[model samples]
Target: MAGDEAIRLVSYDPSWPERFEEERVALEGAIGEWVVGGIHHVGSTAVPGMEAKPIIDILVGVRDLDEARACFDPLAELDYLYAPYLPEQMRWFCKPDPAHRTHHLHLVPVNSQRYRDELAFRDKLRSDPGLAQRYVALKRELAAGHPSDREAYTDGKSTFISRCL
Candidate 1:
């Protein structure tokens, strides 16, 4: 996490879905050979009217983890810097660089628990306004408390996410 960025939440932007779509198209053209399920726009940015960190988080479903390694170089060609975070669960990457990220890409196995959980959380946020608002409030509080610590801010949200699931 040497190049990790600070936690800075921003108001919801209507353009996030378009941005995700653009990235999804590029990603599909670049690595469609390995895609098994589909590309999804997840995370807070995917939920309309939710304040988030302003990064379009995309989840790409593949058949297997070992074979997904082939997607690394292709994604890098698209400016996605691969990160070794949660290697056993998913292949994580951030666009441009970790310090100034515009997107987060997660390559997960189609049938993996992590893939299901991510979509579940996003759907829950999308359908439940009160829950989404509460999540935003918690995020704001966490961002304030752990301004420069991305990991801490994320760690603080686990309990809330668990409850939602």
Candidate 2:
């Protein structure tokens, strides 16, 4: 893997929302209306005043699995790598940065629990600074030792996130 693709935690940038907006608009233009139910700024970057890894995580909700099939392959043309094991009810993809990604794109059924939990968590974090601060501290500590292994990074977060769900 290129060192540029190295995943690590970093202080949050205030520009995450604007970056998401730009990507959202571009994704909407690229995918069109039929496949995209709703696109949102999700994950740690979506919360205001939170420290994050500078990745603009996006949640693209689709109406149905069939609709996703109709469009999933084309998304690959834009570097969206399908990750079928992400969860049963949703389709997940990682759009690697040709220039080193600062983002992760998630595709999900319009109303899945995963989607609900993500939104709920994001909202919860935004509404509760103490919790968000704890999460931020956890992430910083975890990333300090494991900068590039994705599984380790996620595992570090599961305990807290699982409780939130």
In terms of lDDT, the best-performing candidate is 1
Best candidate (score: TM-score): 1
lDDT of 2 at 28: 85
| Candidate 2 lDDT for residue 1 | 33
lDDT of 1 by residue, 1-165 (tens): 777888889999999999999999999999999999899999999999999999999999999999999998999899999989999999999999988999999999999988999999999999999999999999999999999988889899999999989
Candidate 2: tens digits of C-alpha lDDT, residues 53-165: 77788888887666776667677776776666455677677667423676677777876777788788988898889999999988888887677766787899999998876
Report the Cα lDDT for candidate 2: 0.77
TM-score of candidate 2 on Cα atoms, chains taken together: 0.85
**Model 1 TM-score relative to the real fold:** 0.98
Summing lDDT over every window of 10 consecutive residues in candidate 1, give the lowest-scoring window. Answer: 1-10
